[model samples]
Target: MHAALNAAQRTLVREIATLGTESGVGLYIVGGFVRDLLLGGAVREVDLVVEGDAIGFTQTVFSRLGGRVTPHRRFGTAKWRLPRELATACGWTVLDFVMARSESYARPAALPVVKRAAIRDDLLRRDFTINTLAICLDAERAGVTLDFCGGAADLQQRLINVLHPRSFEDDPTRMLRAVRFAERLGCELAPATLQLIEPARAHVAALSGDRLRHELQLVFEEKHSANVLTRLNGFSLLAAIHPALANTADAWLADKLIAAEAAGAAAEVCWLLWLYRLPAAESRLVAQRLRLPVRLTAALQQAQQLGAQRNLGRKLASSEIVSVLAGVQDWALAALVIAAQDEQVRTNLQRYRNDLRYIKPLVTGHVLRARGLAAGPQYAKVLARLRDAWLDGEIHDAAGELALLDRLLLQR
Candidate 1:
């Protein structure tokens, strides 16, 4: 079939083809780029496969495109990332590249032994039919779509069918990918493909956490993330990954997140959906397992505390809300705001989010230290005392808080 390419895409493909020919190697635009083209979707990421040195050829092509090529000599792989602005200019509006020749998995769902191979061999090595398609980028075959596994037909049918029965076992993460493709393209998984995933779910542990996390994050970025999560739960893969994630006693938060998504909320809603169920302990476990960023970890902890207090109806008084807002930077209060059960809490959340509520502590450690309060735990205690009084409405203004601090210091 003749795959259409815009002028910019054609220009980029031409450049890659020229580079391949000049270097005496064959190159093919393969994988998701081909699949997305057949589906008429926007292609932003591109993967190119060469029948020669991937790293060497990538360096040549990147040089032509004036991109920074990072070569992984150990693995014989290379990456060329177009600048955000040039990404679209360079056929990225066409697809992103995952270039390699061929790969052979040692064990089912284990790392592959990669080596150079013909374009056909490379395409045949892919997990699914839709992903096995390739577009010839060379001048001789430009616009020619190659489908060794009937990927074009499957694309037409909007089906996610494995290239082989053992496809899932070769990489169980493909099960999630199948689900993502089904949701992203409004396709259905072939019956055999759906059946194959369950038995292969055990193989997921063999896959790297980074790979699994990437797939999970992609699924969550989808509009049907909640539905996808439900599907994963139904397939029993969710529990297999993290047993704690199963049987969520309170799925209200999940439901709320789904509702928010249905109303066109952004990706942050997905993070909040899991926060209610992920208490401090579980959050820490997950963070450790996922190697979460420190900022995200702290945010999760704060959200957990806020969720617990909100659940307990600890009615975030004006002061409590202000204090919480002061310490949080990122999505710190996302769960509290998203899962807030009370109108007052929601209103306060809005005020805090809009920067309408700012608290300038009326008393400081310096003042307390000067007032016969020695440094150390006492400084912390005095500050905490004043902050509490301010939050609890015991101190209404700076003068009132200072007066209370003075009296409290004198008593001390």
Candidate 2:
């Protein structure tokens, strides 16, 4: 397990272990970092648990490591901040620290009240059994496995199980996470855990918009996000989040999501693409419910309007395509090209993205003014005519553009 770390990570871990031993406190690598290590995947983040005042320990790290320490006293946590350049030179993680703590929720879906506790208590409080496993970082006990929750066994069995029956109830967002982990790991939800999802469906609506939206964003981030959404839809979980999402037509969704993935669309674009087929009003309702940024909500509505246009399927000149799509959100255009079936629509969208939108008349407003043409409605008319000529392949260069300009100015 120690061999999995790169040279810089090894150096930092050794230093942290030395500090923890001298201080007489236990420190362990915990959660996703350990889980990914067991899975033989490249670990992306490193989280550390200290059986001591994590804030103070983080200050110690800052004093010794020459980085900023941002401590959160209320949460018993601190971030060892490092400059990007320094972090890459030293390690992937600057060593984020959290107290090994237990949590109790007064009500379902409420944030947990926490108390500092041993590593065993902390492991039990996590979302999934797979994530409950940890590895000791203390030098004498380095690489020791701590699995009070049978997390390692579950990991071996390729199953996802909650630590307790009330797991999803206490935090509804875990339902989404459960799906995410199960799908990502190619594991199945334990039968006991699968049955609990139905009841949790009722509580999903109570979650804050930010929480639910953030979970959905993670879903889109997955490589096989289409499959995840399919599972969510089958469970009616998507509908529980929003009625408009209730029936996105699985086949259509799969196709567009695949195309979106192929296009390397951002999560925000993926989001709008998911809602691309919804009625404008329902799409707006979902956006409002999720509290999506106003720009995205507006893009969702505009994508529907633009996608609904019947004329897009017909062959059109480049300038005409621009006219139809002018001022449309780039996100909307991106979503449309993925959702569009007509070859002409896709071709025109590509043309506009790559060429038409950026094509300016060689004869500019300045040139028009220099020619003694007043800057008014006629200036716009002549420029539009000149540009259309350029779009239609009537003009190829500045010389052709000048001739077109003369004809346009004469007509004006």
Candidate 3:
């Protein structure tokens, strides 16, 4: 346990213990911290749970630290956002405090009801066994782990096992949580836990778009994103989340996605590439269902259009390559350049990247204005023609640019 925490974290634990001891309430470092420690995973965030009046405890602690505390009396919860970062050689720590409480989910999609509960009860009510482990912060039990749910054994086996079968039914988001844990930890779900997913698959549709979006984003961002998606698809859960994706993403695309995932590619990039094989309408619908951000949605659209044009073969004119490069972000365009299987297409993209002519504007609005052209939207047309000529190698440098500008200015 000493090896699990760094010197700075040890200081935090000791300080927190002093406060809990003074108040006569037990404080424990619970949930993810313990699980990650036992699994030999790096702990980036720690959750401290106190089995007492959370609001008062939070206020007292905040006052001691000279920080503000906000209490939610109805929920029996409190939160303190540290004004300053805890200085640590490893990294500055940002701490938050929460009270131990039992939660009751009304419906799969509805919010949970919160009530103060014993620390053990708090641990027991969590979604999974591995996340339910806790360690006492009080002097007597300091560092002593509390594992009423057999989380330590599960961690030893590198398995994901939920606390109960109703875990998913209570909160459909846990289905995605299971996938994230499996992907992030490189672990597999226990057999019984895996069996519980399908029955609750339909309940996932009941989740709000916002909730589903957050969970799905985590799925793609995980190290095993491609594998997680494949597992979800195999279980028939993908359709419930995004019916359009399941409809259009065939076996070939799935294989591509799996390979990309294994290669340690970014999830967003892999997703965009996979969506390229889909029909435009289906892809748009899937993006909508997944609530993807506007930038990513645009990237996917551009990649699809580019993929379509790639079928036209290696003789892509300089204009087409320039247009493609201009529409995409540098990273995505670079990835597309590397992923291009056709020699001609790859060469054209590389040429656009390396050649000066592809980037130099043929004409500018200032040039148009200089030729007695009115400074309005029509100047845009003049610049576009000149730029097109330059990209097509009709213009070589400033002299050619001036010649083209002269020609456009002579017309309307």
Candidate 4:
């Protein structure tokens, strides 16, 4: 276990143990950090649970570590953003401290009501067995493994077992997380846990849009995100969130997601591609249902509009092609490229991506003004003509641009 940690992590663990000893509080490294450490996966984030004041513990740690500490009073959680120098030296940034607490759901799919509790109770309240594992960081018991729920056994068996049958009922988001974790870790859901998923599908809609969107974003972040989507589709969980997803878009989502990642596009681009075939109103509905950020919704709308142009045929002039794709983001354009089934559309998109998208006019507004062109609508017209000429390969240099500009002015 000690060999799993690098020098920095071991140092941080010792520091935390010392602090726990001084404060007379039980401290342990819990959840993903311990699970990943046991799995020999890269442990990037540190999740600490404390039997005493989490916020006060983090403040004291920050005083010695020289990091900025942010506290959430409501949840008794605090996060420390390691100082730049330390982060540079250690290759870690943030550390989270949470009060060891038990949680209960008031109703199906509602947020958990938390209360301070013992480490055993806290571990029992977690979503999955593997995540319930922890390592004690007290001075006397430092490095001791706590596996009350048989988390290490489940981890060894490569299974995802919910701590309780109502785990998904309490948080339907856990269903999505189960798919994510299964796909991410190459594990399977325990049979009992898998049996509960279908019944829990009914409670999915009770979740907030923000929570749904957040889990979906994590899905996209996975390397085999398509597998997660396929798993969701199989369980009818995607339909539970929004029928449109299953009815209209699920067929192509997995394929487009794979292609989008292959093309090095952002997750939002994959989302836009997923919903690209929906009509304007349905697109708006999906955006609202997911509570998508304004920028992404606008990009989706723009991609849909650009896709509707239908004028990007092979015979179109370079200037017309450039005009069609002028302001579209690379990721959005990549979405369009993947979504386009027509050979002509794909060809045109490649043209814009490879050649015409980078075409810029050599003559700027300042240069045009210096050349006695007034700053008015004609300035735009003249510049557009120059840019068109440039895109068409008719102008190659400043002199060529000037010559084209002179010709346009003469024609005008």
Question: Least lDDT summed over 10 consecutive residues: which range in candidate 2?
Answer: 85-94
What ranking emerges by lDDT with the best candidate at the front?
A: 4, 2, 3, 1
Tens-digit lDDT string for candidate 4 (1-412) = 6777778767877887898889889999899989999999887577899998999989999887788999998889999898898787667788889999989889999888999999999999998999999989887787899999998999899999998889999999999999899988889999999999989899998989999999999888779788888888888888899887774435577678888889888888878877888889978987898999988888898888878876775567889888888888776778888988788888888899998887889778898788777789998888888888887878789888888787877776
Clash pairs detected, candidate 2: none
TM-scores of all predicted structures: 0.79, 0.89, 0.79, 0.93
**Residue runs of model 4 more than 4 Å from their true location after superposition:** 247-251, 406-412
lDDT of candidate 1 vs native?
Answer: 0.71
Model 3 spans with C-alpha error above 4 angstroms: 20-25, 52-94, 247-251, 258-265, 310-312, 329-341, 346-373, 382-412
Report how far residue 177 has shifted in candidate 3, in Å. Answer: 2.3
The TM-score measured for candidate 3 stands at 0.79
The candidate that wins on TM-score is: 4
lDDT for each residue of candidate 2 in 66-177, tens digit (9 for 90 to 100): 7788888877999988757658876664668999999999988887899999999999999999998889988788989898888888988999999899999999999889
Instruction: Tell me the deviation in Å of residue 83 in model 2.
Output: 2.3
Error in Å for residue 159 of model 2: 0.8
Give the whole-model CA lDDT for all candidates, comma-separated: 0.71, 0.86, 0.74, 0.86
| Cα distance off (Å), candidate 3, residue 270 | 2.8
lDDT of 1 by residue, 1-412 (tens): 2346667666666777898888987778777767777778776456777767877787777666666777776566677776566676644522323445577778987877877667787788787888888777676877677888898888888888887788889888888878777878888998988889778988876777677777877876887677677777777777666666665423675577676676565565465556456666876776665565677677777766665554234456665666656676446565566776777766777767765345445677677666777789878777777776765678788789878877877787
Per-prediction CA RMSD (Å): 4.7, 2.9, 4.1, 2.2
